[model samples]
Target: MTFPELVVFDLDFTLWDCGGTWCDCLRPPFLKKEGQFFDSDGRHLTLYSDVLAILDDVDDLGLPMALASRTERPDWARELLKLFGIQDRFPYQEIYPGSKVKHLKKISDLSRVPLDKMLFFDDEHRNLADLRPYGVRCQHVASGMSEELFSEGLELFA
Candidate 1:
């Protein structure tokens, strides 16, 4: 299967096991103790077990990645990515509290990849529905991103 020019991901449940909403108090320089991520407020976050492998596969495919998160705590999200040592993987991040469409528009503008050339993954069905109208291939990651879903996306993009 061919790959999309850019692959965009949602931060919350799609990537990590944080609550529906993250703690606003989370600060920079987050620590990864044991197998989980922790913020200054002691809020714990854990990436789903499949995330690393899927990310690695995407990296091997040499696809540019971006983040489209409707998270109010963008700083916390950025810090968490840094702590996980994957911040550099996504050079185009639109982390803010707004519609996913806005995030995708920014990413599309920056990457110069047309909306149809973008593939998005998010846990929320609403996000997928919203993006579909723009011709972006959207995948619903109900239980975090998995190898199967990633493969399916690749095939669809192809």
Candidate 2:
């Protein structure tokens, strides 16, 4: 296996704390609960060390990353990215509110990057299964997501 030149991250449960639901991170203001991601000054907050570390490793490798989420609001997604100070890390971040299966295909096609050259880090198995036909590898980020898995993934990208 070889490392890919690009990696795609699923935003909701994968990278951000969304109250245990998909799209909870970037839900529209009208749909979000009070203080969903509010910080001390009432600004929205992102995820934990997961976000920083992921970006750091990707940056060290000089690899391209894509934020692939079912988030409906593009503006909110951009805001969250900026809040994390990682807005410059990603060259292509897309918000796909509809079926992720379709979006994954579209992203790969639009980027002109082969599916085999991309690794998807998502918590959902169904979404990963849907991309199997495209030959894209998926890493399930459960509570056990660890450095071993991370290194193992690097093997695929290599």
TM-score of each: 0.87, 0.75
lDDT of 1 by residue, 15-76 (tens): 88763345344554566678677765566677777888988887898888999988878877
lDDT of 2 by residue, 3-76 (tens): 68678887766676544444444344423235345433333454744567767787888777887777766676
TM-score, cand. 2 vs. native: 0.75
Q: How many pairs in model 1 have backbone atoms within 3 A of each other, for residues 3 or more apart or on separate chains, i.e. clashes? A: 0
- Residue-pair clashes per prediction, in order, are 0, 7
Error of 1 at 129 (Å): 1.3
The lDDT per prediction is 0.82, 0.67
- Highest TM-score: which candidate? 1
